[model samples]
Target: MPKPASASALFSGPFALATLSESDGPAFPALVRPDEKVLDLRVALGDPALTVRGLLEQWPTVLTRLHELASTERESGESYRPLAQFRVHAPVEPRQVFQSGANYRQHVIDLHVAHRAPGDERPEQERRAEAAEIMDRRAAQDLPYVFLGLPSSITGPYDDVTLPEWAQQPDWELELAAVIGRPACRVPVEEALEYVAGYTIANDLTDRATVFRRDMPQIGTDWLRSKNAPGFTPLGPWIVPSDSVGDLDDLQLNLKLNGEVMQDESTKDMIFGVARMVSYISQGARLLPGDLVLTGSPAGNGMHWGRLLRDGDVMDASITGLGAQRTRCVAEAR
Candidate 1:
């Protein structure tokens, strides 16, 4: 079972929002329920520009209005539709994407152990201890590793993930993505949580084979070639308002590959939580509304299993309260 939020952390008015393109029309904002029913958010907000980014930019006021509407018109039978009725797009067309790497203690350890990299020359217990020590030092020193991702790689949660032939060892990384509401520049860690509008699920798909440049090993990892494939970042069934999501660190994340559980862990294991990641990123660059910060995935990726994603494979990623996303993988055209 998922952990509950504290009394102080509970949302005063609970609701989530999404973007969907219905009947081939332009995308519109929609209020989402955990049961998967949705309603036209524009009708509730009394606005026509049904864009999630617009709502996020004005979240301070819009959130209040959204709560009111969610209370009154929600139970009433008006404008609601089964989530399947609409063609879902990536919930937000984020202006920028910041993806975290090696943010999960167990995930990094799994990779180090599985690949037997230079650092793994020591015995199992010794290597694990060293890795844990490094993570502790990083947390104590207040540092995080973040990378840029192309917005063009974003795709719908339920969309098919097309794998390019160049990617031999394609993998899945189910992550919890933070959607920014307020612009932040060097925001303090204490005030950083307020900048979050909501949370969504992101499957940060990767190609394990290309992660390290064999030709230029000294140049280091190549996030672009390994992770920025078309539709590689499958995001959102909906963005549950951060307030409504309860305890940020206690949420559970699970990913299944064809009915088998591949990744199952709690956000409690995150070496860097949402607030820290946000505050750290803000110090280096300004974070604008609707920009995404993907907290890294937990352990048990395909790479750890020595079984990469295959053509026609299915991935179902779920984060407690935030909702679940299903993506089927297909080989790219030759």
Candidate 2:
């Protein structure tokens, strides 16, 4: 119950948070090392609390303690487990998940141009210019488009993603996710970063074919149908602290499908940055500690490749400083 230090100060330390499963058992929270090994956080921190949720709830009070313990264990190099020895779980089981949509400038333009009606064809430069203009105007307006995601969709970073039997064109959207540590409601953009607990990598899987409700296209995107499949959201390798992340705008989002680089972009291209997205979504609702805000995926989705996810395909997604996620795709059993 101490006054929360600025995110810049909190993240300046070396500690990060993560969850892991041992022997295929339940998940436990741990302090993820910057290089290798996962320190048992519950015991490392002297156990005033437990679970990833506990870490976030008391982050302000324990941030310094976390740094001290992690630094000692790391420097001492004692009782460490190799990163690959255990199963990495979703960084946290969030109660609410907020996802930004088409927040990447180029990603939106690609979708616009790629899906344009045949009769609306125009020169590539012309189309690009138009899209750029729209984005510029939108940025001036300062409006962000966001949607809800189900907590049930979250899974381990290295887990298997099951392509539901009904899904035709499942796609991958590699994104940077912000973990909210402090509760926020109606917080202004300037003060929003203070509430951020950390950052993580999230693959916002989508079912492209079901994106729009054909019966009610006017009603807009069907986020639930398009995004909330079980294990659809592959999150984490680690929740790298916000200050540790340096500049959110410069983080590189890279996703390789079967060794072929598909999505390569910087968060600089986001139409609405992390602070903006968090502030916008927290207008009326309280963003609780441990809540996740996914900052939308960059372009190069399956729709653009004309090659959606297939059973046995492998996806490896990574963001600068936040570690990587490798998920194997499998067909859902009947």
Candidate 3:
């Protein structure tokens, strides 16, 4: 099981939150400490029906109460349990997941140049320069490319991902996920951050082979079959409140596959920041509490290294303030 780091590095605030399941009971929300101890919010707040999404729906009020709860020392008779006794699941059950694609400048350029047409014989530097220019134009004028992802595809941060047999080239795209705190529609870019409750880490696993529809050249990408397999999205060790996180642009995103560093970049490389992506998505779809808007991954995906995921490979992904998540890959049975 993956454990959180020390208090000084793991979280910027008093505590973070997570969803956990006991041996014989259903999943419940809890306040997690860096010391590996957890206090059940349902029992502490005296609301058994309370959930992470429910808390987010009432974010403003609940956040204040949470601050108060976090300030004081644990009182006698309070039920605090060790984190290891339970299973940690995705922090929130989002009604919708908005995924931003090609939002990172270098990532887009790298992919475009790497997957050049077979017959096209352009010098490597020339191809890269052309791709970079296109990205610059898109960043200045074009709107962000956003798509939907199924909530059912989410799995625990430390769970084993079952790679489907049909997926020939499974790849990893670790991204920063913004958790929405309130209902937002047609929000402006300047005000989009206000609707974000917190932040978490998400690995958006994709099957490279299924990315584009071979049968229909004009139809473009097929994200559903490429990305929405069960356990494809491994999200959260916990959520750190938005206020606790520092400048979004300064956050460092790093991912290691089988103990080798695959991705090491800062959010500064993103063409469209979190605010713009959120604002753009809200213009079309209503973003509800617990909804996740995944900012696109930075450069250095599996494709960049010409190496894709295989059975038994483990991916450890993390962002600056948010905690880390580890997922081991397993092959599907015949």
- Cα lDDT of model 2 overall? 0.82
Which prediction has more favorable lDDT, 2 or 3? 3
Summing lDDT over every window of 10 consecutive residues in candidate 3, give the lowest-scoring window: 1-10
TM-score of each: 0.91, 0.91, 0.96
What's the candidate order when arranged by decreasing lDDT?
A: 3, 1, 2
Q: Which candidate ranks first by lDDT, i.e. highest?
A: 3
Clashing pairs in 2: none
Query: What are the per-residue Cα lDDT tens digits for candidate 3 across 1-334?
Result: 4553442246667778899999768999888876667888887888889999999999978998787766555733475677778888899999999999998889998899878886989998999999899898888795899999999899989889999999999999999999999999999999999999999999999998999999997999999999999999999989899998899998999999988999999999999999999999989899999999999999999989999999999898888878788889999998
RMSD of each candidate? 4.7, 5.9, 1.6
TM-score of decoy 3: 0.96
Q: Which pairs of residues clash in candidate 1, taking residues 3 or more apart in a chain or in different chains? A: none
* lDDT accuracy of residue 9 in candidate 2: 24
CA shift of 4, model 1, Å: 23
Candidate 1 lDDT by residue in tens digits, 1-334:
1111221122223557778877779889887654456778776666776689998999898887777765554544365667667776788999999999999989988886666675446787877777778888988887889999999999988788899988999999999999999999999899999999988889999999999999998999999999999999999877888877778888888998988999999999999999999999999999999999999999999978878898889887788777677888889889
